[model samples]
Target: MKWFEIGLVVLTFASGIIWLLDRLFFAKARRERAGLLDDGRDPVVVDYAKAFFPILAVVLVLRSFVAEPFRIPSSSMMPTLLVGDFILVNKFAYGLRLPINNRKVVGIGLPERGDVVVFRPPAYPDQDWIKRVVGLPGDHIAYRDNVLYVNGEASAYQTIGQYVGKGRGEEMTGATLLSENLGGDGRHEVLEIESPLFASHGAGEWTVPEGEYFVMGDNRDRSDDSRFWGTLPESQLRGKAFLVWMNFDGAAGGVDFGRIGTRL
Candidate 1:
């Protein structure tokens, strides 16, 4: 089932307020009138809920409209994002869209060629996916011999050493790292695993239809992105991931100080 995080936040806020009002006003008044010294302390659950409700509500509003926090779960964006990295996404960069429904009420800007975007899966609209925008509306995209071609022009790539994933991503260490240039905008590092017979190695040419975009993960070999399911509709876009606020891998206790404040 598709769970709505924003809706959950609203419920938490409402419940907390009700609990606080009951304890501070009604309960206190009744106890005082009855001459009973005990005013019945609020339940532990109620206390915690009240304490965290406001904070979470503010976060939910900021996240749904201004910016949102997300964690990289896999190495699909390796070399750019680590598995334990907690990143921030710009919610208003694309447009002001309501969470859950994802209907863009305002059109602020269009997705650029080299932008890192988060969107709902076209095949599975309930699932959130992130990738780099390769082909915009009406752009032809193709991948041959692990090289990307956009609109009949090949993207530039230079070998940049090897990726050495550590901690949670240790298994993917020593993969090839390449400095990729997307249409001369900027250069970014990408991880490429040497896997022969990979399904995404050589994809047939695909033209992004109107109101659609073609995306691909930085980790070319490991991602199941647009190449597998299909292009993402414009309405499916969520936001643009931009920063890493925190990182906690669970296996590694408290926090990963290295990934904090890292920009995406």
Candidate 2:
């Protein structure tokens, strides 16, 4: 289990138990002794518990079921997302699940092609990784000549000219920016760098199995995604990432207020 989650759960439960015990046993004793033995004020511990339990419980519920915030630590999903961007993941977008185990307890929402998601990758189960869902279950996915082909249908890409990188993404400066259409209305921006020296760059092929998904990064040549680690299991899904609420670009030395509230 994640340490933050474990600590939060433990603290919330411990405080709640103390408050319950005070209400059930200690409060009556205090009232009985108020006549002569002592005053009726609750102990400091009880007071602290009463003050913190509600806030902790609300936070736990919101983070576990409603939505959670995550920071973008890499340039994997660049162009659409950026390094240092703080994104909001919709916890219930892929259905409500238990926090630690990630067992889906309710709802039947499944991720579609081109959905940006945050999940525990099969390569590193303990880490939270974000990538765009490129291939759903039973879909044949192929990456050839730096182009995406799904079930023999090549993805459409519209060049958006050279991308000028900002902040930590300065290394990716001058990469070709393109708009990729992943069918339906699932359109998103991506970054690509054309290298003629190695023609077949980042090429791969895979057929997604049942209950698994193939993910990829928008920074086609830079991301370490399903192209390297294999498919992401359905049980490993955390949530669908939707928005960037903040960006604290270390290279820029401060928050980039323009990236605030960017839709993913």
Q: Candidate 1: how many backbone clashes?
A: 0
> Of the candidates shown, which would achieve the greatest lDDT relative to the real structure?
2
Whose TM-score is greatest here? Answer: 2
Q: Which window of ten consecutive residues has the lowest lDDT sum in model 2? A: 193-202
RMSD after CA superposition, every candidate: 4.1, 1.5
User: Residues 1-264, candidate 2, lDDT per residue (tens digit)?
Assistant: 356776887888899999999999889989988969778888999999999999999988998899999988999889888899999999999999987778899975999998999999766767898999999999999998888999999999999899999889998898899999989877888988877853566688999999999999999888988878788899999999998999998788889999888887
Report how far residue 82 has shifted in candidate 2, in Å. 0.8
**lDDT at position 182, candidate 1:** 79
Please provide TM-scores, in order, for all candidate models, with all chains considered together: 0.80, 0.96
Error of 2 at 264 (Å): 1.8
Off by over 4 Å in 2: none
Candidate 1, position 217, lDDT: 92
